[model samples]
Target: MNNVKGKLIIIGGAVDKGSFTEVSFDQNVANNLNFFETGIMKRIISESKHGEQSRLEIITTASVIPREVGPEYIKAFAYLNAHNVGVLYIEKREQAHDPEVLERLRNADVVMFTGGDQLRLTSILGGTEFHDILLDKFKNEDFIYAGTSAGAAAASNNMIYQGSSSEALLKGEVKITSGLGLIQDVIIDTHFVQRGRIGRLFQTVVGNPRTIGIGLGEDTGLLITGNGRMEAIGSGLVIIVDGRQIKDTNLTQVELGKPISINNLVVHVMSMYDTYDLHTHQMEIRNSQYSIPLMAEQDSDDADPKVSADDRE
Candidate 1:
């Protein structure tokens, strides 16, 4: 994982661009309205090798409304003074092989995937030469791959395609499929908190205990580095569901519509600036005045352990 040369900015749905209205659950609507207006886009540009001067290609393959979505992003980037941006409306599978499209992808320093249907994204571009080029650039260069909503969900090796939040706990309610395979060992879900999708992730992790479940809230995202370091960004919460400690599960034994049970599933709630180490399965909270590293075990007698922030420095 550390050998990966690219960066991934996986965002939850409805990233604020100062134009659209977003539904809020436990978050302040006013705060979320401006949360990612500049923060997320700025971070995306700064993380790229050439910053704002980098050639950005916005792939609208997942969206049915590419005309509207593409222009919105172009305007959004222009607001941040990023001028070298273009949109690729690859709606068909054969379009993915277009020489012009291939050249644009090859020359781009950053590629942004817009929100739409995840299945459309995988079905059209999964096994094409275009996908091969994308995988190559990501593995060999300092390329940045950023996505929002459905785009974020498809970034993982495994994806949840069909599942309702309310019934996700029932056996067979959550459907899983192979995704773009840009990142591995984890399943990503977007619009998580606001949509009450925690059950969806819980079911996924319960069945695939080896894969971690990342539930991203609206306007929030994770800045994942090559070394497996994930930094929570934006204004809302990011939930990490770890099932490694599970002692048992009844998912396989239950019927299709039956409710399943699992034991010892661990969860971590994170906000902006918090960091989670994918390799270590540890988390460091930054909002607290002192850095509290949550580990599997700690010698401290307190139920919740604490350590001086300076100690980590």
Candidate 2:
């Protein structure tokens, strides 16, 4: 099944729910309006083929406030005229195996994961019958799997569950563990730019040189196809970390708690209307007519695209 086709909408969290301070508007109308028109949440809903008739299942197991999280998504989608939204409240492992939950998943047109704790998400849902069924539908059916923040990070095989920017590149500082494994050969870090996660992402790719790393900025996302073609969406950047050309690594020589170093790593900073081919490691700017250099500096502090090599030198 090399050519299995499905849609994956992985999003960064904190999508705008509208400005609460805006005057002269009814609270009910404002709550049910399309507040974040350019955000990943709207895109996910649009990508689903069923439109108004789409059967959406929101999984809020990852969130600490599951009760509040599900309703937020419901209200947002309700504004989009999607009346058939349901919540799968699978808090524990046994709940993941519920026959009713499995039935809801099977009948749903789109499955969405809300932001919370990545580790909690995978821990509860991993290896369950529901997880298996979800994967099966994703591969064989015309299903759309969408997630934000922790939900987005959980889609990868190797998930960066815990890590702080202060000690990101240090050996043993970055924590990685098995995720939902919806996607392979890559690691995902969400709320990337907002949380300053580039250091950890760089560390992840350097350690697993063959694997790619995706750092998604808040409100930004990638609509990735099964063939490894990624289309960037939303207002913020999508940082792609490629370690295939890395050299002169000192990770092995360093002690477990020491700093790690590597050379010649390739990084790409992408925004809306950018298309990248993971298979070929190529990028194309859809909005621009002429080709421009796609390389970015390795500094996590400055997220702006760098033009000169001397800037880093």
Candidate 3:
């Protein structure tokens, strides 16, 4: 992970695919900006080794309506002049072993997963040869792994499968399982602010305090590259919940249906252009003229609280 050559673009649900259904909003105010205009997909292309010529593959294994979802992405990429893109509807585990499928994946520069049920993605593709190839490429090559919604949720090492937003505060209400292991020591949750799922993330981090929780708002995403450096993208917010400083928690002592309690949980609200270092637990806010450094722990009483441009690397 220290020398990771690949990149991850984890997007929240409701990304604009050129349909223009509705303009993006921030804090309930219409921004009239879409993902296309915001340059999210364009960033994906630019980050790739081949730029627009990169062979992009869309995996719709998580989607129930792959036919509908797949075409929309194709059009979206086409609108960006990326014509080499294709969709792979791998609905069963058997399809994951197909030689042709593996070959196409091996040749692809970017492989993106579409939104649906996160469990479906883990169940069908967890131990397949296809999964192995993707993992190897991501670790060794200059690959780009992008995902949206359910796809984004399953990109981390841990995934939340069954959890109701309204009842997430109670013990055993938020369910978690092993994910694709694309990223370690982190958990991703999508459609965060719009669905009011911060409580779910809170419970998860409380249970596993070492893990970092990311709540990505709709139309928003994190562009993670090179040793856990994440940059917020799109129009909405990205919430980072850090439980490393937690002093106490009643989660283990609570009953299954009882609400849990935790003390000293730290949270940082990030917007577009904000950067966070997962390794060092440092944050840099770009919206303001000064760079606000939210460090995990102060080195000394006189340590500068501001993050300089050199500290970002």
Cα displacement (Å) at residue 279, model 1: 0.7
**Compared with the true structure, what per-residue lDDT tens digits does model 1 show for residues 134-227?**
9899888999999888889999999998999999999888999999999999999998887899999999999888899999998789999899
lDDT by residue for model 3 over 1-313, one digit each (tens)?
5677889999887644222222322322122225676677888898898989999999998887777667667777877889899999899999999999999999999998977889999999998999899888989899999998888999999999989999999999999998998899899999898889999999999988999999999888899996889999988899999999999989889889899888999999999999999999999888676644556234454456596658855
Question: Worst ten-residue run, lDDT, model 2?
Answer: 17-26
Worst 10 residues of 3 by lDDT: 20-29
Q: Name the Cα RMSD for model 2.
A: 10.5
- Whole-model lDDT, candidate 1? 0.85
Looking at model 2, residue 172 earns an lDDT score of 86
What TM-score do all the candidates reach, one by one? Answer: 0.87, 0.86, 0.87
- List per-prediction Cα lDDT, in the order shown: 0.85, 0.81, 0.86
> What is the lDDT ranking, best to worst?
3, 1, 2
TM-score ranking of the models = 1, 3, 2
Error of 2 at 280 (Å): 1.0
Give, for candidate 1, the lowest lDDT window spanning 10 residues. 18-27
Please give, for residues 25-79, the per-residue lDDT of candidate 2 as tens digits. 2345445233375656677777887877889999998888777667667877877
The local distance difference test score of model 3 is 0.86
Structure candidate 3, residue pairs in collision: none
Pairs in clash, predicted candidate 1: none
